[model samples]
Target: MQGPPITIRLLLLMLTSVALMTVDHRQNHLDTIRAGLSLVVYPLQYLVDLPSAIAHWASDNLSARTTLVEENQQLHARQLLLEVRLQKLYALEAENARLRELLNSASKVGEQVLIGELLAVDQDPFRRRVLINKGSDDGVFEGQPLLDAYGVLGQVVEVTPFTSSALLITDPSHAIPVQVNRNGLRAIALGTGEAERLEIPHIPNNADIQVGDLLITSGLGRRFPPGYPVATITEFEKDPSQPYARVVAEPAAHLERSREVLLVSRTAEEPSP
Candidate 1:
């Protein structure tokens, strides 16, 4: 049970370690033994490191997936914004085309004209009227004629500081003096509360009017300028039993579709015959 004292045992162990280190350093005696020990412990070292390696791999994968998700969301939002902008561009292109057509009509009118955008349309089915953006401040006066690209649209009936109301040619209370462009036969075109139809009353049964005749403003009333297209006769019926012939014509202007119109000045002189 008894052994050497503690100081003597510690000195002996230190001497042994020094001797082994000297032999390993100078004679390379421990290289074979060190290789054998490393071979035996390599699997144990790998096992000990496996959990930390797996944790690092999992963390990298999760971070990559989160980054991809965020990038995808950003791209989707960008795509939606681009689509909205493209739609607006298309609308603007259509508006520009319409404005060009208005300019062409203005050139043919040979009158001082102001472009007016439609602000509102009357909701009443029987009343074909629309509100325009220009008014007295813009020289838009009552009885001022309105025209679209194709033909006469209407006349301004009410005016305010910044807006005006116009009665379309198809309104029931509206009437315009139109004559047959083919034969100079005079007739009155009266609105019948229909969007496309105008009734030409008081045409004699023996009148020279026929179907497919073009009707133009006769400049008789002085309300509208001369030689402006108004309507085309679609139906002409002669009834011997009736005193007047039944005539129906379609409006030339796209009253229900025009979004922009021209407010024509009243000073346009009549065309020379």
Candidate 2:
């Protein structure tokens, strides 16, 4: 039975809602009842929202973790690059030091000198030779003298347009004229295919040579300049039955380790006294 018109029913419902709101706002008469209703509905509301809350939390945490990992990897890569650069800087410092030594030696020789870098070392055990970057194009010629900072290294044996080969003083086929610095007794130093050994053959049994004597170039053969160091006497042996004494010397130049060397000019000035 429709006892009331639509307009009358709407007005009555509005009046009832306003009366309940006024009472709840002033006297708080519906507080307990409202609280009980909220308690009953809270679990349903949370249940409906749980999936979205979980999704938001997981997305935020996972994204933050991914960002941190990426940043860490980038930092690690940068550190490795810096370390490599540092190592290169160290190598450059050592190279500069070696160049400085070569320059000083050049100045001491008081001659026109050209600097050359070693390209390759001879692999043959019997040949102690090295290839250099300087060649005939750079005024390098056969029999040109090569010297390191410490002493005479060798002489150029072969020259090309862009490269040259040097026979080290330790090669079995190499020989240099050297003299004792103490008494000026001249002798020939012969290589033995050993890095550290040079033999002084034809020394008389009564020769005045002694161990620890410095051997310098004697300006003979006109190949190497005078007064340049060659080696130091290390061992001397005399056999009464033999006319010559067996003498061994160690090279002054670091043949096995030098990376740069100087080539003396053909008309080079005399070395400093």
- Clashing residue pairs for model 1: none
Deviation from native of the Cα of residue 218 in model 1, angstroms: 1.5
lDDT of 2 at 19: 95
Instruction: Give a tens-digit lDDT track for model 2, residues 1-273.
Output: 768998999999999999999988999999999899999999999999999999999999999999999999999999999999999999999999999998988999966799999999999999999999999999998998999999999999999999999999999999999999999999999999999889999999899989999999998988888899999999999999999888999999989989999999865344322
* TM-score, cand. 2: 0.80
The TM-scores of all predictions, comma-separated, are 0.76, 0.80
Score residue 229 of candidate 2 by CA lDDT: 96
Ten-residue region with minimum lDDT total, candidate 2: 264-273
Candidate 1 C-alpha lDDT tens digits along 120-169: 99999889899999999999889988999988888999999999999999
Residue 146 local lDDT, model 1: 91
Clashing pairs in model 2, backbone N/Cα/C closer than 3 A: none
- Residue 94 alpha-carbon offset, candidate 2, angstroms: 1.4
